[model samples]
Target: MFQDLDATLKALLDDAAGPAELQAADVSFDTPDKDYKPAQATVNLFLHEVTENRTLRDEARVMERVGDGYTSRMPPLRVDCTYLTTAWSAQAGALKAAEEHHLLGLALRWLSRFPIVDDRFLRGSLKNPPQLYPLPTVVAQTQEGRSNGEFWSALGIAPRPAFSVTVTLTVEPFDQVEDLPQVESIQITSTSIPDPTLAGRVLDHALTPVPAVVVTVVETGAQTTSARDGTFIVPGLGFGVYTLSVQAPAKPVEQVTVTYAADHQTHTVVLSGP
Candidate 1:
């Protein structure tokens, strides 16, 4: 992947230089140290750093349907590749500085015009397999936590006029993709629920309506109290036979058997004693 990026950068620079005098200058990726030297005018783009672009990081997985199954894979990793761009001229004295400065200026101008590396300039794997994402370019930007003076000093060379270029690229995290079988059919089932209710009244042996009596269904343990009108209601019961237990103040409990039906009707329970 790094090699592909190098080739792509070289191609872009070549296009930028076009058929002008700068076209004859060699584009090198070699480390520029004290011992480094070029025979003619050259543009040195040293790949100085590579780091993941966390802001562009994606954790989602991509899925595609193929034949009878679906293939899924993690999203590609995005990384920023930083390059230290410097110009070199074989000429000496003030002429050398002038030519180097001119070359650097032209390179910077051309690179700045492009926010993304054009697809036509891509080479090698970047072109053959085709890129999934656009290559975003950042020209002449200050690198975080990097010092140009220290970089030159570490290389045992004097500080020179240079700029940095960063390009964002995507890398596939894995080659293997998971395959899932396609679902052929779906089934759904539903059931009808019955909400039957029981309503009744309580009375004493004298055939007078009795209030404040507790009415309970012995089978389901459902209970309700008779209202001031001596009527009580119990909802959410299914169609079946249920035993009603009626009890009033200072009276014996009375048991009445009744059948609950879809067509509801009030039943009367008469206590044996007053």
Candidate 2:
């Protein structure tokens, strides 16, 4: 993958320098040190740093439909590759500095024209498999807190006029994706809730309204007291048969059975005297 990126950049520079007749200049990826010498004009792109682009990091998995099923895989990892670009000239005296600066300027300007590396210049695996996302480019940007002087000193070479170019690439970590079966059908069921009111009146043996009498449903243990008018109501009753127990002051508890239905009528329970 790294080699593909190197080829892509070389193709891009070669195209850019073609019109200027600078294509004859050699494009080198060699380490520029004290003993390094070039026989002709050269443009060197030294890959110095490679780091993950945290800003473009994605943790979500990508899912795609495949026939009757689906396949899911993790998103590709985005990485930034930084290159220290410099130009070398074999010309002597003042001509050397002028020619090098001119070459560097042309490379910088042409690369800056594209925020993304053009597809026409893509080479190797970059063109074969094709990139998942466009290769983004950053030209002539300052390296974070990195001193060019220190970099050249470490390389045992004198500092030269140059620029930085960064390109972003996506890497797929997982090749095998998980396959999932598609849903065929769905089922839903619902039931109606019972919300009926069981109402009735309490009476004495004399057939007179009897207040202050307790009425209870034996099946559900639901109870209610007779109102001043001898009326009582038990809510939330469903269709079924239930035993009613009635209790009056100083009287024996009386028991009666009643059936609750959709059209249940009011029931009258007669209590015995003490």
Candidate 3:
């Protein structure tokens, strides 16, 4: 990817500084060194640094539907590529300085006009199928609190006029998975649950539990006898409204209404007069 970026920048410079014939080089900043021949003009673009563009971070993963399955992939990573671009002319004296300045000026204007590298100008591996998108180029992006004096000194060359070129590249993550199953069809079946339950206590006028009282559901003909505690529970009744009659010694038939649901239902019956 970096090589492709280098190619793209060289092509742009060549086109802008016509006839000067600029070529991208991997040489040090010092132009007078043996690495540079004092023969013709040269444009050196050194990839000084690279860092991830944290601000452009996106969703960690993305999903795509494919036929009967889905594919998941981590989103592409964005990186900032920094380049130090300097120009040189082989000849000495006024002519050399003039040529170098002219080259640098043209390079600056060309890069400034193209804040984004056009798709057509993208070269080498960038033109490949995998990398379909064009990289964004900027001439002098803000590098907070940083200086290049050490950079020049380390290169063993005196600092000259140079421009910083920063390009943003998107790299797709390699971790991807395909062919996860999807829902085919949904099958739902009807179920009849006998959950209805009737429960209550039989009490006399004295407010005391009356044991052995019989409770009957008139609609369903369901009957139950009260236990020692005067409580009766009729389980597994169907859902519907029902009338219940309580029978106790010397007690008139006390009528009560009950609405049974899919859940338990309760009704209290009181027996009084003889």
- Tens digit of per-residue lDDT, candidate 2, span 64-159: 899998999989899999999999999998999998999888788878987998999888888888888899999889858868888898999879
- Per residue, candidate 3 scores C-alpha lDDT tens digits across 153-232 of 88777788888889888887666575556756543322334444667778776556788888988887889899886788
lDDT of 3: 0.72
The TM-scores, one per candidate, come to 0.66, 0.66, 0.58
RMSD, every candidate, angstroms: 18.4, 19.0, 18.6
Q: What's the distance in Å from true for residue 248, model 2?
A: 56
When 1 and 2 are scored with lDDT, the better candidate is 1
Candidate 2 overall lDDT versus native = 0.84
Per-residue lDDT of 24 in model 2: 70
Each candidate's number of clashing pairs is 0, 0, 0
- Arranged by lDDT with the best first, the candidates are 1, 2, 3
Q: Candidate 2 — worst ten consecutive residues by lDDT sum? A: 186-195
lDDT accuracy of residue 99 in candidate 2: 88
Off by over 4 Å in 2: 16-18, 183-274
